[model samples]
Target: MTDPALSELTPEQAQMAARVRRMMLIAGLTTGLGIAAVFVAIGYRLFRSEGSAPAADVTATLPRGARIVSTGIAGDRLLVTLEVGGATEIRAFDARSLKPAGRLRFAAEP
Candidate 1:
């Protein structure tokens, strides 16, 4: 409403105008927050770099009949699943250093 109209507003009209103003204020704050979040994400990506990675030597020799089933990265570890003979073997390795972290074997119950 125009300034002249607002000056002659009834009580109910004034209440509705106040509600509309409050909604506009909330919308402005939400938009401002969304913009700030995008800027922060851009700054983080530009400032953070891993630099030159160190070369790590790791060699694993699987059994004659073993074959890799799947590979994935979880957190800081690399998960390697292999079907060796009749059992399922899962090996965890440190992603950065390529060091063997742990191993697990699952066999079917006959």
Candidate 2:
């Protein structure tokens, strides 16, 4: 006995099914490509280096009688404000390598 519901599809129905399958395949490929791109971006960020080795240990020496008033980070530099001999000094160092970048001193006029 042949079941009507399980019978072969009409020509129009078969064409419609094929068109739907094609659309679904395109959508699936697009979604898969997007997910692959995301994974690639994440992998690049995780594995790539920033062209400089990170410092394992850093030691910055301060002058005698120099007291650290404040410390902060500005852009890519680390800033340290110090009070030395009644004068204020601002020192900037490279945040990555801990190298001295520049210095600023504030003094009263004579």
Highest TM-score against the true fold, candidate: 2
Tens digit per residue, CA lDDT, model 2, 22-71:
99999999999999999999999878957767555888899999999999
Q: Score candidate 1 by lDDT.
A: 0.91
TM-score, candidate number 2: 0.63
Residues 1-110 of candidate 1: C-alpha lDDT, one tens digit per residue: 46886579898998999999999999999999999999999899888966656887778888899999999999989999999997899999989888889999998887
| Residue 83 Cα positional deviation in candidate 1, in Å, after optimal superposition | 0.4
Query: Cα miss at 82, model 2 (Å)?
Result: 1.7
- Prediction-by-prediction clash tally: 0, 0
What is the lDDT for 99 in model 2?
A: 90
Q: Residue 3 error for model 1, in Å?
A: 35
How far in Å is the alpha carbon of 99 misplaced in model 2? 1.1
Displacement of the residue 20 alpha carbon in candidate 1, Å: 26
TM-score of each: 0.51, 0.63
